[model samples]
Target: MKPLVMRIVFWSVLVAALAILAGVVYEQYGRYRAARDFPAPGKMVDIGGGRRIQLDCRGAGSPTVVFEDGLSIDGSLSWAAVQPAVAQRTRACSYSRAGLMWSDASNAPRSAKQVAQDLREALMRAGERGPFVLVGQSLGGLYATTFTRYFGSEVAGLVLVDPSHPDQVARVAAFMTETRSLRSRIAVSLAWTGLLRAAAPSLLPQAPNQTEHDAQAVRAFAPKSMVTQMAEGDATDAVLAEAGAFRDLGSRPLVVLTAMAPYTGSELRGMQITPEQGVQVQAIWEKMHEEMAAWSSRSAHRLLPKAGHDIQFDDPRAVVEAVLSVVEAVRAEGGTPPG
Candidate 1:
């Protein structure tokens, strides 16, 4: 029995050492590979010294529609289903924020306010003649509103897909502070390390129809695997950023899309969120809708019955319609949406 116990302990130490060595090598290789093959947002102009912000211009006409992706590594591909349909009637585009796929990692700042400013500069540099109808998903919603407020005159209308809510941030923070889960903490650490690694890679422009490609680009920079803690940290930070952006918005024509379903992806399931949590999130969204309703007289809310946080991917047609309506409203007002 004593000999067996000792052997077990020796093997455990060996496994631990192997893990550490593997992690160090992977990190070094990842950083090096990322720097060499970082996706570039081609023909996309940089603003504020980072290529993370990119513009993909398509079609032409009136009330140009601009789409901004949510947090994580999302890009214009999130609008894959919606942009083309909208482009048929008016000028439309979807952009990758800095540190996201096809966009250069940013070193300046990651605040919503800073991101909005970058969008402003990108538009000017790209020569995108706007009365842009700004559309955003999740954290992108925060940036969209910030842009509208800073460049109020340039904005024609707004569409927010599962837009981040400030109150939601408080709730998330409270939960994280109270929860003492080791799994959650480890997950967060892994996620941050991956994000940091992506920071070193250069940004590039991608194909308009290359949704899968875009996903692959962003995935390449993520850690070998995800853990629960990493997800919690990411979610918490997102909510906090949304809260900050919410405080700065002004009255604007806006349409917000809220999700009705809980996400059931492999990642989400791995996190062990239960059906009860789904119901709770729906309830939270209801309250969030009420809070957002007070933002403007024209502000309205829509429910995406099938989607979770990533509403666009779940139901692109609905997002397109909501965005188109905003574009029309801006055009009707004889104004261009903010680019």
Candidate 2:
């Protein structure tokens, strides 16, 4: 009886050891997969701070148009309709901000102002002579407006696609877990981290790579870049506060496109937005349109009935039309339309 008990204990220990070893192997494999599948971006430029931004430059003409992505995505190629359409009339560019898709990592804070400043430098260094029409989506809209405010006359026009209001910084802050509710915030953060870890094992590419080649393409694109910039302590609120003051943005011919429908996708399926809250946000945007119209007689709003936040993706035609309209409006205003 004593011998049998000892043998059973030994077997249990061996099985536990094997399980531990398997966990280690799985972790290593997950990391390997992430590194191998990073996105392949075109045209890289080192803009100081040991960081490089990936850019896509094409077309040629006056009133060059620059496209900016949303929170954590960078696929300029995705702007198939608008880029080509506008490029026919003027120089055009679409690029990934640092940490998205094919761009290099940067320790810089991801504020709208910082992004706008980086864009200016990129244009200068890249020899993209302005009279530029800056176009941005979502948070990119904040950057676009901020860019116009900072650059002033250098920018001829501005376009915003359902931009996040500076006021939204307050809303998001009130809800974000870190400042308001630590437990909830930590839980949310842990869930995101765990999801990535689990997906990393089977989601990434088999072979390791120098550039981002992981199945978690969004992760490879955003993790290192945005976290350092926008995800820092109440930074989003600070950026939005600065964005709230739009006195300087009034100088340019601005166009605002709004999405009227509710988000129904898997990502926002269970998001809790009270009916009153939805009405209030919509009202605020409507008021913003009125402010925009008052800001410039030429500033107008176009509603996209079936589109979501990423209007560029959901309704590229609408995006293209808005851009083209701006180009034409600027020309009509004698604002030096792109040649």
Candidate 3:
């Protein structure tokens, strides 16, 4: 009886191990196929140190409009809903940051300053000249702020879509009994082991097209992608601290879009925050967004009534219009490219 029981236990363990190995192999094969079938639609430019970043540019005219992605999101896909429309009006470009999507992974520190510098190098190498109208969403907003601070002359306009404020982490953490940092750590760990990839849906329901679906799959499971994201998350405080030292935009053309809808009680509960705490979160987010708008004397602050944090996905038309307004403002001020 004991021998029979031991045999059963050993067989069960062997089956489970084989299943996990099969899942890992399947996911790896899927990643390889996705990369081959849906190659980058734009040029891969060497930023420096033999590392390459993907940059996709469309249309023509300048000051060029550059789109930057939110944290961990694909730079090119995040702007899908708005970029094509903006490109019709002016030269528009979106790029993958180091270690995201089609870009090569980097060992550099993942702070806003470092990211902004990388972008500057990529733009120069790609010959995407600017007096750029820089558009950023979420954490990309921090990079935009840093870029404007260091390369103010190169940026002709700025549009921030439901932007993340430098003080967001500390302020929001103060209100929550538990933060999402631990969850993020676990998720990244699972990604590294390919467990998340094995479980994640092959196609994102929210993905509007095949290109975006492939991009989402790559981002969802890539260990290097998660490492870059974790690095940025860990450096948020330091990035925000440095952001505080930069001077305001003064009279730069700026537009700040603020999302007003708070998470529902159930949604807050799912995140382990009480409904009351969720209210506080929304209030603080709005307050911080208002402060961001105040950075530029010429800025316009628009409250998006029903939009969530990813306003580009929720209400892309709003983002498109905001960017066009900035482009028109720059062109009106004779910030066009030289003939």
Query: Cα lDDT of all candidates, in order?
Result: 0.66, 0.64, 0.79
Clash number by candidate, in order: 27, 17, 0
Rank the candidate models, highest lDDT first.
3, 1, 2
Cα lDDT of model 1 by residue, 112-212, tens digit: 66677877788788888677788888767777777776777777778888887666656644222324457545544654344434432333234334465
Alpha carbon deviation, residue 319, candidate 3 (Å): 0.4
Candidate 3 clashes: the total is 0
RMSD of each: 6.7, 6.4, 3.4
Task: Please give, for residues 212-287, the per-residue lDDT of candidate 3 as tens digits.
Answer: 5655545553554666777776777787888777748867789999887778665677667877788788888888
lDDT tens per residue, model 2, 219-325:
44333333333353346666667777874565467788887766454323233455555556556665665565455545778888787776776787888889888
Better of 1 and 2 by TM-score: 2
Q: Candidate 2: minimum summed lDDT over ten consecutive residues — where?
A: 206-215
**Candidate 2: Cα lDDT at 225:** 32
Give candidate 1 misplaced runs (Cα > 4 Å): 1-42, 48-52, 171-212, 221-251, 262-274, 336-339
